[model samples]
Target: MAQSRTTEHCVQMPAHGAGQGKTAAPTPEKQLNCFVRCIALIERLGNALGTLAFTWATVVLLGGYPTALSSKDFRYATAIVSLEAARMFSRNNRLDYQLLFRTRGAVRPLGWNGLTVIVPAAIIRIVLASLRLGSHSYYGDDGHLDKRNPGDKTNLVPSLNIFYGMVLGQGALYIAACMLDIFSFIPQRSLARQGGYADDDRLLRKISGQALTMLAMDSVNNCLTMLRETGYVFIKELTSIIRVDRYRCVAASLLRSMCLHAQQELEESDQRELSYALREVLERTLIADGAELEIFIGLSSQICKVIPEDLAKELEDSHIKQRFVMRLVDVLNSYTEPSPHCPGIRRVILEQAINMMEHDSRYTNCFIDRHMAEALSMVEETVSEAENYSLFLGDVGLMEAREPLSSLMARAKQLLAVR
Candidate 1:
């Protein structure tokens, strides 16, 4: 990978001596300056067109369409007039900042921040032009009018609603796009603050932590917004789809993919705590209930397979892994129904799997062994419950299997290792 990726790129010119023959010169700065001037001119032109559109509307009302300009002429003129105004604001750098103000609170990090601003701005202009055309059509005649007394224009107040609608619609689009525009400078800014304020390790850790935090926040926000907007429709749709085994399989697979991504990023990062935190967040978000406990296990197993044996041993020995597993088991158990064959009973099974995976692996540090043993014991109890319910699952699916109270009690002793 390159050392740094800049948002704006400039081509380098070949070195030239004082007497170099007719060498082409660098013009990036000149080009940028020209772009700024063009944007300013567009904004000024837009303001002028807006004024002209307003004037035409007012004059059209005072004088009938036949008296001023033909209906078609008015429509075309109004469209052109509104488009210029829209173009002005769309090209203005300040408009992008205005869009982001709701979330980021009036911060101008990078001016307009590349094409993230350009696209919506152009669309807004097109929309404005359409609105102006529609308004003129609605208010003005199709060139057919009574010569004696044309229809009154005072009833054309609804025509101005175009401007109101444009602001609401285009403004919303601008804000939505701004939310999605992720400039690379966010992490860069945090990294820059590292000097003197914090040591390299601490700064890197914080940067990594914030990255995970942003991911969590963005995911939740997007999901909740989608749910809020289409929750009722989706509920009906899900009712039909949830019954299909294939749908469940597809959903479980997608969730596994998301979890795998989180795990991989955490594993790659040098900050162990941040990685563990991300893993915990994933578990908490996706595995809230034991509905897909087996899928979680299968995915974790797959991820563990890809991990290097030596590093996996170090990871297992570290407090990060054991602590995350313990917390996960605890949360899983709390949500697991109390039955011998209930998946909560399978929590211990996962612990055993984790232990088996780490058992032969040696840790250079002895202190980690105690925590590992404690985590294993917690897993053992959960597994003992599952053992009692295995007989029930022999006849029924694991989801439907529930252990008898007496069997559960009996299994508790084995699980607790009490004679």
Candidate 2:
């Protein structure tokens, strides 16, 4: 009887322990999951606070709130806040396969909705601030009309402040959107694995379209702002701004974006109209000599990769070919002394010229006949006596240059034979 009682006690104790063990196992897991949720909540709250703070600061500074800060300080603060906001929005609202695939159009605005509110609000604040400044200037600080004359300097200060604030705010938003668009190309592994080429192409087109749309909106905003500020002088001021070399960089970026869109369309549709549009943009861009020229060169290199046949045919136009060849010769002439930035551009131009030549015998014949002498002259100037002799004696850079030129010459000769 004692043994039986001892066995029963032992079995009951184990069952009780087993029940406790089962109860204890899930407690740690539950605690871990709760902790993770808390951390996520804190992170989200922190982001919200940061974004709110940035938006408030932008409004206050651009709105010209009465503060100890000078105009310069206000300008700097506005710029900094704008950049930070851009960085934040870009981080949160990335353009990726996940965004393109998972989300429906109805819910898409929620991703970047904050930006829509913030940008317009800032613009309105600036306009109201300008109105207040104008009112104060006209009515005097004491609220009575001042006998003092409103000089040009008096009017100019407020206008300048308003113009700068609006431009800075709009520019920041544009930069952020651009950054988002550029990064949208990063492939999401899960989406990519499930999707096909057709899906990827669709995503690319959507991204490109969005980028173009943003560019258009920015251009229109700038034009409208200029018109509002300068009134009748808007056209003159707009022309002057467009003429600036820095502004040409913007145009180049716009052109590059357009080219990317055209390239995509060409791939999908293989339409001659797209090719012609690309040719027209390229022709206009090539005519401009400035930072734009470098951009056009880069664009041409990209075009060579995508639309070589179409581009070659476009170059076969006598006027276009002549202008392009002359530009190449000028670029070569600049590279005669071998500057730091020249070699890379020179190589691309040469490669593009070679591609054109390879694509069409007629273009090769025209290019070699019209520009070969200029190229040889530039090459002779570039290759010094020691470098020339070292070619037979095997100098690295000289040998590298010789090989491409020789290959180009060989291609030209072959084209001439075929002609």
Candidate 3:
């Protein structure tokens, strides 16, 4: 759906790759005297990337795998890319501009009233590196006071305590900055702008709230999956996966929401903007550098859902429905990721396709198009394999009486066959 999450946040390089305007054209006085443009550009880069790094870490290190896919991740990444984008972050109270500037964005503000924030952080880090505080100082490899000569008065290296404190401080500031990114969201005012009334704002809030809630639920569920009761954990996991679908259902609902919202509520300009935003959200959530099968399955299900019906008669959707579905079908035809662990996606991808065919003539045409037949067959195999794996576990000492994979798989297969 998107080339990268960081696209929105890209730093404005001075005359290199940024500012395509006549007024922005560099002058000899601006260049030779103080390097003002260069300094400002560096400051902007430092603020954007430095601040966003904390938020990005909260996603990848703290949240799900392929963390770049989430809207939350994009939200932060966009901030990191540019100062103009950063303005958007602060425009709707999406971020605390003051607390943020004091932390990662500047660390220590400088220049004419916070025009450049990189000065203090850049200076401190530079000084630390020069002192070689945590490096090969006079104390040698271990940096122990005991190993150093008492008579060596020339040893001007900083104490290990000071070095450790500096290192720890860096980490502390990062965590604090991460707190800002973690709490930020697509709040009601983020979408509510000129020409958008109270009702529109309320609707936007509702939609945003629902999307955010779903994402939070997924995050909680991902965390929950890590925990297992003492015994029969393997069988329990398999059984749980049998009656499941997560992302597919989410994508379906979101697609439905986006189309309906665009059709009913927005003006032409607002409609395009809102639709694009939703698509980007979809792209950010589903498409990825390390795209998961579950996401693609979710996407595929929604494609099946979207193609069959005209949810918005006048609302023209761009790229989301058509291109991605073709890509999804192609990917599914070649999808090699293990389905035994995340069987929910395998179940729903087929189910959505099957369900769509029953009501829509267009869906019937879609049923036999492209490489869908092969994709469906592959999905069916995954279901069969997952069922077998679950049964094998049950057959072993890891048995559970209320087993569901067998019956579930049969029903799925029956439905698939009927389609």
Candidate 4:
């Protein structure tokens, strides 16, 4: 019986050497395929090396190292091109090529995007060049021009030239690159909307949506920088001349659109990843300058709804929940006086808190037992005076604040009961 079974198994399994005995000659097509793959790998490596070399060169240039390639003009040009390439790489999500292929260490934390690094580095180089050029006049001892006599309003020429290059040339290129980044999502978004791949397209839609959201954030940052740098007079006269409401309206609309798109595309798993990423980023941003708080709050609100219990439990286990909650509380506490924007942010926080409570019963007891009193005290203090309430609720629209406040209070009661 054993011999019969062995014979049956041998007959069922094909001979391992059968194909080797009848080897077919390699074809031209097969050779071409191998050649193409080799070329692709080489090209990928070359691009990676070029990016690293440029990034290192940028750092060296920033450090004021006197290299053979360190001419002012060359540095400026290199900075612009390198920054543009970095932006392009980030937009295409190719920034991970090096990390994936070469790195042995754990992946870097993710809140700060490529723009945070590249844009500032480029701007610094340009500013340094401008300052250096500005310090000396073209009218030097070589019969070029005259030296400054008690600062004669400083040499405006070189400074203005630098400003023009940064604003017009490099700035235009950055803007164009961002627009292209945004536009690249259109085809993917279209495919998602058309249901081209049905459930399989969910991940694609989430990725594209996230990319667009990041691009929008970068664009907003760029615009804010432009306004801050160029519109000093406008900023001074902001209250009297410019209607803050109009600017707020436009910003809110843009944020709302991005949030809606991102929320629509995200699956539960996507939400978990996004939550993890955003929290890390938020923690970093809060520690840094906190410039991206508005965008962070907007996105957080969209993703905070109906979180999966498993994800909530994971976050709880990892202590992310406590950290995030504390950060939100800190944000709320920071705005001592009522601002137009504060109400929207507060509403989102309350909504998110309430969602957490509903999704995981443990969250209510955990948060309320630890943080409820402090959080409520901060909110109460913010809205304490009638004038402040009027501003907060009026700016937020009374109808909008009513529901969130009610829900938040109800959740608070539940937590209080548990405690």
Candidate 5:
């Protein structure tokens, strides 16, 4: 897995719609979890600060700002912009982090997501309150100490009180104290009352333009990770992938995994979307130049052989399986020679193709037209006295044929010839 260094620290979102009631008090585990949330919030804050600093310094030194904008205006603009950008980036790229920490361990207890949000929110409000209190310092108590904008509001920062910030973060305590104080009196309320309690959430990253552009690029690097988890994303890198010898089996294993998954959900209608996705995987790997990706000249052939009958029944009944059969037939038709060291790759595909055609008239015609007579006869002629191919994960080789590949091929040929 080509994981980023930050991947290890990736936190997962909480489960959706958890009916479990919130625990009354933080347990030892919960407290430790609280610490973790705090750390994550701190990490996020540090990144934001760095972005703000870089944004401010670059504009000030490199003269990126317009002549009308004061230094302070540019700094505040960057601050506001950076915060919004960071939050948006974090929200959008959550899927990437989720893909990395994909195991069950990624899911924290219910309400942890609430912590992710609440922790950052709580800290920011507290820091704001503290800054607001200090903004009125006598030594620096200029009229513009709070604001001089056309609509600058007073009580912009409440007193440095945790309870006030914890509850009324966006609201000020004494609006009459400042110019826009009247509107600050418009109070807001919500269900949460406990100090640090937070609940249901799902989202998960950052850096800027030029520099921001670089940061954005850095955060959007889930493509490589997706190739590990999703189908077909890695084919773009197939040239590099095939060079690594062990990756051959790894690629084959993906096909096997997709096959078993389709079989498990063969009867479910809702799975049509997923079935089609798997079908593409089979086609790209099996029907189209599947020979080059072979681990042992017949790796795809093994998966093709193990393809079950439920896949071959009816297109309406199982689209994915039907597609599986269709691709396997193409594979059989494309066969040049059977695996010299192993017999099952071509042999199993040939056998299953015959079985499916006999069982389903829909497929029989397709097979007879596509690969039934020509390909079957070609492989059948190469059938040996020893061609027992049991498709197992362990010992991936053609098993000793107690009854001979030629005999099995004879029966398959007879079944097709009669049809």
Candidate 6:
């Protein structure tokens, strides 16, 4: 009877499987992680392969050629290739802009960067030919040779022409690949036409400031990599300057956008949204404290410049509006230190202040004057006999004195007095 009862007992299992009614997958986050990993992998591989190729080419050609290939030359080539690959991969492969365009039957190309390279290369080639840089130099039967041969020199002109042609040829191909990328940005016909040609400045507007800022950082890092490969101090500095400028431009633009958003919110009588936007702008400006303040301040100044004087007056008249200015001053203090003509971080802060001052006579005459005076005082204290210039970008530490760093405090007070 017990055996009969046991035989009737059933063991059940779900048909679907474990986690059949599982939680939703983190599809977006997972994809983002994968994308980032893929990019990093590609970049690493490109850098390694590019350096190796350049090194190998230089070594092999040094013995066989009259003029050895310089590290700078090889590095430049590698940088061009690496950046080109990255731009292409980002635009077409990863983003799937091509596929999206096909659905709509709208496609376009970007040719600006090619023009950028070609123009520079063309000019350099012209200068080289005029100066006869590689003339009278050759690799002959035995070894390297330098001789004045009129006929050879005449023939060499064609060779030089060919060299320039090669440079342009490479530039052209690179441009073609870049043009393929244009489709990604040009989704609608109106958007594409409004965006203008590849070389047009309007293209900058299509990219968000945050996106541009990220790109700027990447570009800087790439430039550093280039510097290590090339070992040319001048080029490295040039790249650094460009990177810095790019950051400033993006930051400033972002600030302007934020201000516009805030203005729109105010116009719509959406106080909650206005407050949210203002808070966001303030947070961002403060976050940029570690960097130069030019972008942040420049953005503020730009906003002030464009808004009607009556609105500006209304804003200044209100406590809420004054809070915005105070927020700016606080950010400026956190972002910069005092210096003549405001180099580095100071330059950005001061430039923005000056720009804002230029727009309103009252701000120029009163508000900025007071703030400058206060800032000067802070600077004086910061640069007393002890000369606490050790720390920069405004990360002041605690004082051991019970009286609380009188000298530093006095400098700050003095700055206020001056203003």
Which candidate tops lDDT?
Answer: 2
TM-score of 4: 0.32
lDDT of each: 0.36, 0.41, 0.34, 0.39, 0.36, 0.35
Misplaced by over 4 Å in model 2 are: 1-274, 312-318, 339-343, 371-419
Give the C-alpha miss distance for residue 175 in model 4, angstroms: 26
lDDT of 2 by residue, 1-419 (tens): 00100000000001112253354443322232233223223323333444554665566444544243445445544765665465466543222112111222111221345445444544544454345445443222334323386432233344435544444444444434333423344432222333323354443333222222222221332223222333334222222323444233333343343334434433233334335445644665467543345546755655665667777677666347777766776776666653322233444456566666666666666666665556655664554322211011112222223334445445544554565
Expressed as tens digits, the lDDT of each residue in 296-411 for candidate 1 is 44334434433434335545565355544454445444533433323333433343334334443332122133333344445445443333321121233222123343443344
- For model 5, the superposed segments whose C-alpha errors exceed 4 Å read 1-276, 285-287, 290-336, 340-343, 385-404
In candidate 3, which residue pairs get closer than 3 Å at backbone N, Cα or C atoms, i.e. clash?
Answer: 9-81, 9-82, 10-81, 69-284
Candidate with better lDDT, 1 vs 2 = 2
* CA RMSD of each candidate after superposition: 22.4, 28.4, 19.8, 22.6, 23.1, 20.1
Candidate 6 residue-wise lDDT, 45-141, digit = tens: 4334333433433343323322433343334334443443543444322211111111111112224543464345334433433333334232233
> How would you encode candidate 5's per-residue C-alpha lDDT over 68-162 as one tens digit per residue?
33344344435444543554365543322231122121222213453354346435534544553444431122444434552322332221122
Q: Candidate 3, residues 217-286: lDDT per residue as tens digits?
A: 2122211211111121322222222223322233333333333222332234433333333343345434
Question: Candidate 1 vs candidate 4: which has greater lDDT?
Answer: 4
Worst 10 residues of 6 by lDDT: 1-10
Model 6 clash pairs?
110-179, 342-347, 373-415, 373-416, 377-411, 377-412, 377-415, 378-412, 381-408, 381-411
Model 1: lDDT of residue 308 = 35
